[model samples]
Target: MDRITALRARRAGIIEQMEAIVASVGENEDLTAEQQSQFDALRAEDDRVAAQLSQAEDLERRRAAAARPAAPLPGVTAPVAGQPAVPAQPAEKGLTFARMCRTIAAAGGIPHVAAQIAEANGDGGLFANQNMGSGPAGGFLVPEDVSTEVIELLRPASVVTAMGPRMVPMPNGNLTTNRRATGANFSYTGEQTDIDATGYTYGQVKLSAKKLAGIVPISNDLLRASSTAVDRMVRDDVLADAAQIQDRFFLRGSGTDFAPKGLRWQALGTPFATTHIMTMTATPDLQKVTNDLGRMELALGNANLPYTGAHWTMSPRTAMYLTNLRDGNGNLAFPEMQDGQLRRKPVHVTTEIPDNLGGGTESEIMLVLPQHVLVGEHMGIEIAMSTEAAYKDSSGTMQAAFSRDETLLRMIMQHDIGLRHLAAVSVLTGVTWGAA
Candidate 1:
C-alpha cells in the first residue's frame, strides 16, 4: 500500500490499544501509586500518538483534494505533461509562432522572430502588427505550389549571372591538321583567363499592402530571415556565376574591368571597380518559381516560426538595402527592410518614393543615397552586413551586430510569399527633383 494507507492502518491499531488501556484503568477500583503512574505514562504516550495521527490525516485530506480534476481553460486544450500546447479552438487556430520557426528552419531558411500581436486596432479590424517575423505571421497558409505528392517539390534554384576561372582554347585548325595535302598551316597558342563570379543576385515577389506605421515595431527576430536570404543569394549565386558555360565564359576578380556589375558593392562612398557594371535579363519561368515556393513552404511548415507580416514582397534593389555602414575596421553592412515594416519603424532607412526625389508614380524611396549620383549606374555587392540586434541597452546605448554567418544567410528565405505578392512594387531606384 501507499504511505498514506500504511499510516492509516498504524493509527487505527494505536487507537484500539489506547481504548483497551482506558477501559482497564476504569474497571480497576483501588490502584497503587506505582500502577497509577504507569497508567498516566501510557495515557501521555497515547495522546502524543493521537496528535501525530491528526496531522497526518490533515495532510492526506489536502492531497486528496488537490488531486481532483479542474475545469479546462476556455480555448486551451488539455495540457500534455502538465503544460498546455496550442489551444484547440478554431479561432485560436492552433498555430504557434515557435512551430513556425521550426518549419522555416526545416526549409533551409532562418526564422529569426515569432510572436502574436493584437488581432484588431481601436477601429475593430484586425490590427496590422499582428505578426512579428518572416515565417508564420498569422496562421499557416499553404504555399501556392506545394503538393501532397512526393518527388514534385524542390528547393528554389540558385542562378549565378557570373562565371568561374577558365582558359581560352586555340583555333581547331591549329591542332593536328594535314599540313601538306590539305595545305593547312598549324600553330599552338595558350591563353589564361580569370573567372570571377563575385557578384550576388536579388529578386522580388509582390504582396498585399497595408499601412503599419505606429502600429508595431519590427522585432529583431523578424529581420534575421532577410539577412539570411541575402547571404545565401550571395554565396550560392557567386559560386554559380563562377562556373563556366559553353555560351558564357567565367570572369575573375582580377578582371574587375570585365566583372559583371563591377563587383557590385552594396554601399560604398566611391566605386570599387568601373569594370564590374553588368546588366540583368530576367528569365521568367513560372514553373521554376512555383517549385521554389513549394519547397520553401515544405521546409518551413515543420518549424517554430516567428510572427511576421503574412504578405511579403522582394526587390533586387531598394533604398533600405543600399546603405553602407562600417565598424572601426571599415567593413560593410547593408541596412534593409520591407517597405511596410520600414514605415512602421521610421528609422531613417527608407524615404517616401515621391518626396524630395521627384517624378515617380511609385511611393517609396531609398533612405540612403550616394553623396554624388551617377547617371545610369547602380552599385552592387554579393553580400552585405545585416543588423544582428538593434536596440537600446541598459545604458541607453544603441547596439547592433552584423550578420556574418553563412548558415544564417541561408535561413532567411522562410518569409510568407502568399502575403508578400499582394502589394505593389514601390521601390525607388532613382531620385527625383522638384520642378525647376
Candidate 2:
C-alpha cells in the first residue's frame, strides 16, 4: 500500500491497542503505573502517526491538483488556460503527397477543394504545377491541424511558456485585471460599537498584445517529397526563431515601442521595494550563496508570501560556477546541483541572463513565483505565403526581389506578459563566479 494507507493502518493498530488496555481497567479503579505508561505511549504514537498521515494527504492532494489542467476562464473558449489551445485533430492517414495537398487546401480556407486537390496531387501535381506562385492559385492556407501541431512543438522549446505562468487569453488587443495593492487590516473592537472600515488597496495589471513575426523559405522540391519532413522543418524553423526572441524579451525587454514589459524591469518597480533586491557581499561562495538565499526567504516571509512553487533562475554559466565550487575539504559545496534543485526548489538556467560582473555588468539570480507572472497569448498563429514580396533583412536593409527565389512563409504570433504581484519576485544582483 501507499504511504497514506500504511500510516492509517499503523494509527488504527495503535488505537486498538489503547482500547484493549482501557477495557482491562475497572470503571472505579485507576490504571496501574505500568498499564498507564503503556497506554500513554500508545496514545503518543497514535498522535504522531496521525500527524504524518495528515501531511502525506496534503501532499497527495497538491500533486493531484498540479496534474490537472486549469479551468477555462468564463466566456472564453478558443485559448485555454496555461497553454495555447490546439485545434481538433483530423482523421489519421498515411503521409502522402495527397495528404500534403489536403492540408494546404484546408489551411488556405478552401476545405471543399481538399479531396479534389488530394486526388490530383496524390502523385505530386500541386508543387509541379507551372502556375504555382504567390497568387491565390499558388498559395494554400496551412490546415488548422498542421498549424496546431507546429504550436504544440513550439511550446516545449519556449522557456517562458515552460515555466507555467498564469496564462490569460487575449480576446481583444488587451486585457486588464485587478490586483491586491494591500491586504485588509484587522483590529479589536468593543461590543455593540461600529467598526472602522478596513480599506483594501488595489492595483491593476494590464497586458497588451505585442506582435512577433518571422519568415522562412522552403525549397519547392522538398515541399513535394514528404509531408512529414516539411512539417518538421517548418515547425523547427519557426520555433527556433520565435523561442529565442520570446525568451530574451520576456525576461528583460523594456516596455517601449510595442515591446512587452519584462520580468526584470517589472521586479525593480513599485510594491517590490528595495528590500526585494538582495546583493551578495562578496563573490559567489557557499557562505555568500547561503546568506543571499536566507535574505530572500526573509523578504518573502516578511511580505507574508509562502515559498511554495518558488524557483531560482540564472544563467547556465552561473550555475556551473556554483556547482563547481569546492569546500575547504575539497568536497563539492552544492551536491544538490546535480539534481537541478537548490534548497529543494527548482533551478532554471537560461542564456538570457547575462554574466557580466559589477557596475551593471553583473549576472542576476531571480526567485520567481510563477503564479504571480501573467502571460497572455492570442488564439492562433497567422500564416501567409509570398514569392514576389521583397522582405527586409535582419539588419533593417531591404533585399532585392530578384535575390529571393524561394517562397517565404510568414508567421505572426501575438502575446503579452505582466506581473500580478511584484512582491512575488526577488532578484540577487552583483553575483560573480568566484573571489574577485
Q: Pick the candidate with the highest lDDT.
A: 2
For model 1, state the Cα shift of residue 327 in Å.
Answer: 56
Per-residue error (Å), model 2, residue 229 = 3.9
Q: Whole-model Cα lDDT per candidate?
A: 0.28, 0.69
How do the residues 8-116 of candidate 1 rate in per-residue lDDT, one tens digit apiece? Answer: 4455455566566556765556566866676677667667766776787688688888897887989967667977576765521212222232233323332211111
- The digit string of per-residue lDDT tens for model 2 on 346-367 reads 8888888888756745688888
What TM-score, to 2 decimals, does candidate 2 have?
0.64
C-alpha lDDT of candidate 1 relative to the true structure: 0.28
